[model samples]
Target: MKKLVILGAGTAGTMMLNKLYKVLDREEWELTIVDQYKTHYYQPGFLFIPFGIYKKDDVIKPKSNFFPPGTNVIFSPIDRIVAKENKVLLEGGKVLNYDYLIVATGTETRPSETEGLKDKLWYKDIFDFYTIEGALELHKRFKDWEGGDLVMCIPELPYKCPVAPLEFVFLADDYFTKKGIRDKVNIKYVTLMSGAFTKPVASKMLGELLAEKNIEVIPDFYLSSVDNDEKKIVSYDEREIPFDILTIVPVNMGSDMIERSGLGDDMNYIPTNKHTLQSDAFENIFVIGDAANIPTSKAGSVAHFAAEILTENLLSAIEGRPLDAKFDGHANCYIETGQGKGALIDFNYETEPLPGTFPLPGIGPFGLLKNTKINHYGKVMFRWIYWHILLKGRELPIEADMSMAGKYRV
Candidate 1:
């Protein structure tokens, strides 16, 4: 039997396993998935973890629960990928050969990448919500905390869920208001980008909202290092922003194995054909999710869209046919804007977010690029859909390709 090996049983890998399991003939092909951890995290829920909206247990489940029974699930850390030999070497010294390989190993937070960021003040005054431990620790610190110079900063771009840091700032504003400490807190958002967001029109809208909320915005601040003792972030240009409490979204990079295999770019992301989702270095290998150096948002929705195209392309390749299925960098994200309202944005490689009614053009239950309660509910309801539908590889009502049907083009 031909071996089909998938690395990292996270959202992307798990979904692919389910999709391919039903399609690949069991007698002729064998599927194997490997990951170091036993538990799977609903990563999107991590955004709410620091706000006490979601407990750690609420976002975690056994990795084995979602995987197909027939596929071999191995809990082992990958030491390196010997791509030349078409094999993965685990930490335990086991070598697994593959007829075809899928690299879904996702990105990770590198707090140490910034000097002094992980020093004495880490988790005391500085915290990150990207990891489970950091979120839980921040939750505890936020409970008894009185407010002062509360700064939410993003060190650089291409971070997981580009809007997450903005969401954190919005949620923090609401949290402090509810705790009766809003008056005492000076809320500030510092980012490397030129505006509140990457896109110009959306950034303008969001910037206006931030001003109305009285949250200060500091743009074009390229963070060089953190001064833990002084409680300030120093930029490469020598500019400094002082903070009483700092919530940081640090540097994000792809899996270490990609670097070890010499198959990744400067940020450790594999160089993949943006439309094909196939590795530029090898035809038999493919990359998806945060592992691919694609221009789309490093988001779950992008991965879902990529999976649809990849499924078709993989089948075509196996049949010695041309791969015609193309990924258009589709990404849909819900921005939680505090107070019981949220905004939705949908776009692809060639398009920026625009104002529109979503899913059903004129009769949308959700609005795009505008804050609404319906969008908030959609954001809240996604957690249920993630475990029940997305990870299970079930088809969702939304189309895989970006749609202009419900969107209003200017």
Candidate 2:
């Protein structure tokens, strides 16, 4: 039987596995998946851990729980992908050859990439919510801590969940206020972007919200290093900001195995056809989610949308037909604002987030570009949807390609 190998059992890979498993002819194709970890993390839930909205138990489950029965799941680190040979070399010297390969190994935080970031003060004064350990540590620190200078910094771009830093500061505002230390806690949002966000309209809206919340926004600050001894983060231009508590989004990079494979870019992201989600170097290889160097938000929503398009394209390719399905780079995010409210944004490659209703042209239960309690509820309910529907390869009401029906230009 021809072999189909999937690398990385993360969200993208798991979704694809389920989607294809139901459709692929088991008699003709042998399906297999590999990953290094035994646990599956709800990465988005990590954002809430520091705020006590979620606990360690809420974000984790066995990797086996998500895999479909009869799957040839191998828990092992990948050494490298030999694309020309159509083979994957695992760390244990096991070799697997494939007729088709799907790379969904996602990006990861590299705190060490920034000087002094992972130093002695790490998990003491400095923490990152991108990882479970960091989030749990920060939660512990926040429990007994009196508020001081709480600084949220984004050291790089293309990080997972672009709105998370903003959400962190927003939630921090609420958390400290409830603790009755809001007055003592001076929250500052430090970002490398020119504004609160990358897009203009959304940035303006979020920037105004930050100001209203009395959260200082320091823009264009490129983080150079952390001065663990002095408790300050220094920027490339030599500006230093001292903080009592520093929460940061570290530099993110694709899997190291991508680097070894020589199939990746400077950042170790695979060169993929943005529209097709297919590797540019190999016709039989496809990349999904954070692994592909696609110009879109590296969030689960993008992966979910891309999976639908990819499923269609892959099946077409299997039949020796032209790949007709195209991904439109659709991404949507819920920005949690303080006080039980959140804002939503939906856009594709050609469109920036705009103001209007969502899913339904004029009658959305969830507002677009507007902060509302209902949007927060939508985000809260998504966790259930993620575990039950999304990972199971079930179809959502939303379309794969972005629709302009409910959005309006500002």
Candidate 3:
């Protein structure tokens, strides 16, 4: 029997396991998935946790609840990937050899990378929304506190759910308004980018929204270090921004195992073919999720799209055939603009987001590049789809490739 080992039983790995379990011959193939975590987090829900929209129990589940039978689930941390020998070294020095390998190891926030950021102020005056602990702590801090300079900052880029930081400020604006403290709280946004977002058009739109909300922005501010003692953040350009309460999105980096294996770039992301999702280092080793250094938004929707094409490519590689499917970096996300409204965007590697209808060109219930209440409902309902349909490898209404049928040029 041929051995197939998938590392990190996150979104990508779990979906691939369900997809392949039904197709691959049980007698000819044995599959195993390894991860140190027993709880699976609904990472997208982290943005809502601080707002009290999602509780701790709402965003997590046991890993065993999702995995289908016929696959071995090992709960252990990985030490390194031996790509040359096609084996994996676990923390306890146990080795597992495989004929084929899939790397779905995802990224994590590293606040320690920034000097003084993780100092005394962390979780007290300073908080982050990327992890459950941070989100829960911020929730308590927001409940009984008086208003001051509420600063939301992103230290660097290439973070998961790139729209989340924007969503955080939006919700904060509305939350304070409802509490009758909107005038007392001065909201400020500090980002490393030159605009509100990565894309030029979207940045302009979001930037204008920030202005209308009376939110101050300090663009092109590269974070150098945090002065926790003074409650100020210093930038590389030597500018200082004082904050009473700081909510930050820390520097995100790929798995340490990728770095240990010598298969990743400076940021620890694996060098992968943008279209094929196959590792450039080894033909048998494939990558998905935030682990691959792909030029696209590191979001969950991208993982679902990549898994569809990757399953086909995996079959092609195993059978010694040329890969037929090519991923187009198709990614769509719901931007929670607060007050029972949200905005949606759909685009690929070539096209930028523009106004249009989605799913059905002319008859979309969900508008593109436009804020709508239904879009907010879609965001609320996606939790059900993620648990029932997505992890089961069931097909969604959307396709893997981008469609220009209803979209106009941005």
Candidate 4:
């Protein structure tokens, strides 16, 4: 029997496993998934924890719960991948050879990458919402705290859920206002990007929203280090921004195993055919989610859409057909602008986010680029959809490829 091994078992890995299991012939293929952690985190929900919208229980579940019954699930750390030999070396010296490999070992926040980021102020005045611990700890710090300069900083790019920092400041505005301390809390959004977002239209809309919320945006500030002693963040050009409480989206990097295997770039992200989701180095090896250096938002929606395309391409490769299915770098993001209002954006490669209704023209329950309570509801309802429909590889109402039906270029 041939082996089909999937690494990581995170959102991308688990979804791929379920998608392939139904299609691959059981008699000819042996399915397996490997990961270091036993718990699966709904990473998108991590942003809500600091604001008390979601709790620990809501974002976590046993990894075993999602795997199919016959799957050979291995909860062990990966040492490295011997790509040339088509074998994976686990920590205990055990080896698993695969006929095909899916590298879904997602990206991670590296606080250590920045100087003084994990120093004395860490988990005290400085916290990241990327991790469960950081989010929960920030929640505790926010509970009884008198407000001051609430700094939400993005040190670098390619972070998971790019809109999260914006959401953080937006929710902070609502959170403090409800606590009767909106005036006391001076919220600031600091980022490496020139505007509020990568896309021009969305950035204008979000930047205007920030201004209306009385939050300041400091753009193009490349973070050098955190001055824990003086309680300030210093930029590379010697600009310093003082903070009372620093909530940061730390530098994100792909798994070290990618580096160990010599299959990744400088940041450890696997160089992939963005249109095909196949590793540029190895034809039998595919990459998905944050692991691949795909020029799109490292959001769950991107993974979901890419998974559909990947499933088709992998099957074609198995049957010796041309891998013709293409992933258009499709990404759909829901931005929570706080106070029961949110905005949605959908686009793919060669297209920027546009203003219009989503899924249907002039008849969407959720509006694109327009803030509405229904958009907020769409986000709220997505958590359920993620667990039930998305992770389970069930077909969603939206198509894998992006459509130009409702969107209008401005």
Candidate 5:
């Protein structure tokens, strides 16, 4: 039997495993999934953890529990991928050969890439909401924080959940207001980007929201070093931003194995065919989700949409057919604006986020580019959908391609 090996049991890999497992002829193929960890984290929930919306118990589960019956799972760290030999070497010298390989090894934060980011100030006055540990630490620290000049910054772009840092500051604004110390606390936002987000229209809307909340913005400030002793972030242009507590999204990178294998771009993301999900270097290998250097938001929505296309293309490849499925970089997300209200944005490679309804023309229970309580409910209900439907590889009602039916090109 031919072998199919998938690396990383995260959202994309897990979903792909289930989707492909049900389609591939079991009589003719064998499948194996490898990951370094046993637990699967609902990463989106990491955003709400610092605000105490979700507890630790709510966001993590065993990776094996999501797999289908008759699937092979190996829990071990990988050493490197020997692409020349089409083999993967495990940390302990174990090797696995594959007729097909899928790399879904997602992006992760590397705070050490920044000077003094992981020093003594880490988890004390400095924290991140991207990881479970960082969020939990910030939660504990915020309990006693009097909050003076709380500065949050993004060191670089291409970070996972691009809008998350903005979400954090917004939630912090509401969080402090409810605590009755809103006047005593000064909330400030710092970013390397010129605005609140990457998209122009969305950024303007979000930037206005920041203004409405009375939060100051430090735009276009590139970080050079963190002076933890003085609690300030220094920029290459010699600009210094002082803070009482600093929250930062550090530089994100792909799996180190990709770098070691000599199969990645400078940032270690796989060079993938943007529309087809095929690897640029190898015919039999595919890259999906945050691991692929696609010009799209590295959010879970992008992965879910791409999976629908990738599965079809993979099946075609296995049958010696041309890959016809196209991934249009479709990504949609619920942006929580605090006060039990949220906004939704839908767009793809060819289109930016437009002011419109979603999925149905003028018939959305959910609103777009507009904040409402119903959208917030959709955001909360998504956690349930993620565990039950998304991880199971069930087809969602939404289409893989971006729909312009409900959009107004304003």
Candidate 6:
């Protein structure tokens, strides 16, 4: 029987496994998945953990819980992917050959990459909400903390969930207000980008919101190092920003196995076709999620959309046919603006977010590019949807392709 191997049992990998398992004939194919970790994290919930909205238990589950029955699941660290030989090397010197390979090895935080950032002040004064441990630790620190120079800084770009840092700042404002310490807290949002966000219109809206909330916006400040002893962040140009409590979004990079295999870009992401999701270097190999260096948000919604297109293309390749399905880089995100409200944005490669009703355009219960309580509820409800529907590879009510049906073109 032909073998199909999937790396990483995270969101993207699990979704693809479910989608392909039903379609691929079990009589002719054997499906296998491999990962080093036994637990799976609901990554989006990580953003809410620091604010005491979610506990560590709410965001974690066994990796094996979602795998379809009859498929082989292995818990082992990958040593390298020998693409030339079409096999993977495990740490114990075991080699697994594959007829086809799907790489969903996701990105990781590299806090150590920044000098002094991981020093004595790391969890004490400097914290990151990207990981469960960091988020949980920050929660305790914020409990009794009197407000001071609270800085929310982005160390670099191409991080997972780009809007999370902004979300952190907004939630912090709300958190402090509840504690009656809003008057004492001085919130500053420092980013390497020139605007509040990567997209132009969204940035303008979000930037204005920051200003209205009295959150200082510092753009174009590239982080150089952290002064643990001095309690400041030094930029490459020698600019210094002092902070009493520092929240950082550390540098994000793909799996180290990519670097060891010598088959990835400088950031260790595999170069892939933007539409086909197939690796540029090999036709028999495909990449998805944070593993692919596609010009799209490395967010969960993108993975869901990509899985639909990828499954179609993978079948085409197996049948020796042309791949006809095209992926338009569709991505949607709910921006939590705090105070029991949120904003939603939907766009693709060619379009920026425009104001309109979503899912039914003219009749949307949810508005796009505008803040609403409904959007906030939608954001919160996603955790349930993620576990029950998304991971099961079930089709959502929304279409895979970006649509203007319910969106207003201004």
Give per-residue CA lDDT, model 6, range 319-344, as digits (tens): 99998888888999998989999988
Clashes of each: 0, 0, 0, 0, 0, 1
TM-score of candidate 1 against the unseen true structure:
0.99
- Candidate 6 lDDT at 283 equals 90
Error of 5 at 24 (Å): 0.5
All models: lDDT? Answer: 0.92, 0.94, 0.91, 0.94, 0.92, 0.92
Against the true structure, candidate 2 reaches a TM-score of 0.99
Model 6 segments beyond 4 Å from truth? none
Q: What is the overall TM-score of model 5 with all chains considered together?
A: 0.99
Candidate 6 lowest-lDDT run of ten: 401-410
Q: What does the lDDT come to for candidate 3? A: 0.91
Which pairs of residues have clashing backbones in candidate 1? none
Off-target runs (Cα >4 Å) in candidate 4 are: none
> Measured by TM-score, how close is model 4 to the native structure?
0.99
User: Compared with the true structure, what per-residue lDDT tens digits does model 1 show for residues 334-380?
Assistant: 99999999999999999898888888898888898898999999999
* Model 4 root mean square deviation, Cα atoms: 0.7
lDDT of 6 at 370: 82
Q: TM-score each candidate.
A: 0.99, 0.99, 0.98, 0.99, 0.99, 0.99
Query: Which TM-score value belongs to model 3?
Result: 0.98
Backbone steric clashes in candidate 2, count: 0
- Give me the runs in candidate 3 sitting further than 4 Å from their true place: none
